[model samples]
Target: MKTGSLIAMLFPAFVMYAQPGKLVWEENFNSNKIDTSVWNFETGTGVNGDWGTGQLDRATDRKQNVAIKKGVKGADSSCLVITTRAEEFMDRKYTSGRINTKGKASWGPGHKIVARVYARDVKSMGQGFAFWMLPDEKPVGQKHMMWPQGGEIDIMEYVGSIPFHNLGSVHYAWSYENNEWQSWNHAHQGFYYSFKDQEVPNPSEPGYGNYPPAKNDTIAGSWGFHDYGINWYQDRIEFFVDSTVYHIHYLNDGATLNFAKDGENEDAIEEINGKRTGVSEYSNHFPEWHPYEHNMYIILSAGVGGSKNTYGGPISDAAKFPCSVFVDWVRVYEL
Candidate 1:
């Protein structure tokens, strides 16, 4: 019964970048509107953040929160905006937007995807801006297998509280030593990689967070435009910021969750692995699951939260309404 309200829009078009390989897909966001032909909005409070972290506000299609407009520099370029607010709506203190290319765009092994994005704001950057992918609905016994088994590819994720850092991660399910179906995410659902100097908590804890505490200015698209690129290989996926490799997730030979053959959703135990109460640590083989070898589609979203217990919670209250994550453009090339 709950639905979203669309606001009046004032946006422009975008230009395509020159890159190698065939230009299979691209979103200029120029149509002065969100071309629904290539994107679908996800409306509601997210499961993990809303159910567990109590972090993000509900997602709506309101133009105030999601719209296309002038680019970061000016109107010469166009961009998509996902804004977060401090206003109350539908039992939530804030509101935002999330969109995905579900039935429209999807990719498998041997592909190159890049999203020119601008996250972080001068006054409001503590929330979260994510560019990731979900599975392309693999048929199971009686339904579509999702999450852990299907796997998650997080191309770029940044939290304002951690300023100057960007995270790359993947999610899958595994069978533990106790033989329980447990879901898991690599590198703390973020790998929590920092491109700048930041203080560490509980340094004694192994793999607690980034080490050496170095400082730099690669602040994950705070200003200008930054490319979050992903090179999807058959056995591994590499994440890059410009030409630098920040994270690489080596995958197994087969599917991570191949429990049911087709038609049915759950396997033997009806359990999922790697469900985090909050951000945690990650490694090569921890929860004991394999990498997912399947197809997935893209998602672009922004939400408020990222201090502590929530998903990017406990951030500076200086971030008020109308905070936004801008997407200059998104392109996928055949490799």
Candidate 2:
């Protein structure tokens, strides 16, 4: 083995103990102008659809939509704010801000990504804010797939429609066909936590406004600003809210793969002429490949529009306009 590799394994403490949770990169947004070197504005109604979920807002690069606000109350210094306004623009009723670190910076295993956000205005229907990641747009030395297949890591997703609920999720291809490879046969597995309370109420509950005749709940941010983060490991990922881990997703759970391909599928096996039928029986579904072992870029956005059942559900008639989500800072640390 290489000397460096052996040292790393033998004295893990020597390498990581010196600077536990070392901050590798950060964005305080203290400058007058956004550092274009690290962030790029993503504007438009998405390339081929309503930005994947039929959101009503169209992203714009206008300063009003995304800008650095100074002398912010409660925050330490300037904050990066993404505002969603209820105005007609580009055939959309609302305009918002979306920015990302597609090629500038990306992180993978052994790293923790976190952001401090003040989302009081993110309350009210039709408004949403998120801190998420996607596979590098131009991954080096490997082929990358598109959405659903490419995979996504949602560190934090808060919607005004969900009231006290917040989300953390990862999307991956569960099963697919060789012929129809570019399909949406994906599995979305994650958990939800509450900003006000530790426990999240069920949607079926009588008082929950998540159902028909949506609730008029307009609760705002949790405290002034809260931290949302994700600790990425080679075999698992942990989601955190306010520095506490709330959920974890394991890459392998000891379940055998449905087909001969090692550990790809988790379905029950069948017999075909005394041999395991594996994935052949299902024409539409095939074993899935582990898709989170690659580099992924960060994305922070605010979206508008949705139904009562979904995040950022239908905009309530009483919902106010010009909602904004403030981000105090973002940092990536070595684990």
Residue-wise lDDT of candidate 1 within 40-81, one digit each (tens)?
998887766572455657889989888998745732378898
lDDT of each: 0.59, 0.67
lDDT of 2 by residue, 36-92 (tens): 999999999884546776688899999989999997777878999999999988788
| Candidate 2, residue 94: how far the Cα is off, in Å | 0.8
Clashes of each: 26, 3
Q: Which candidate is the best by TM-score?
A: 2
TM-score of each: 0.71, 0.77
Compute the lDDT of residue 322 as modeled in candidate 1.
Answer: 70
Candidate 2 lands at a TM-score of: 0.77
Runs off by more than 4 Å, candidate 1: 1-20, 48-53, 74-76, 120-126, 176-220, 253-291, 306-310
For model 1, what is the alpha-carbon lDDT of residue 174?
43
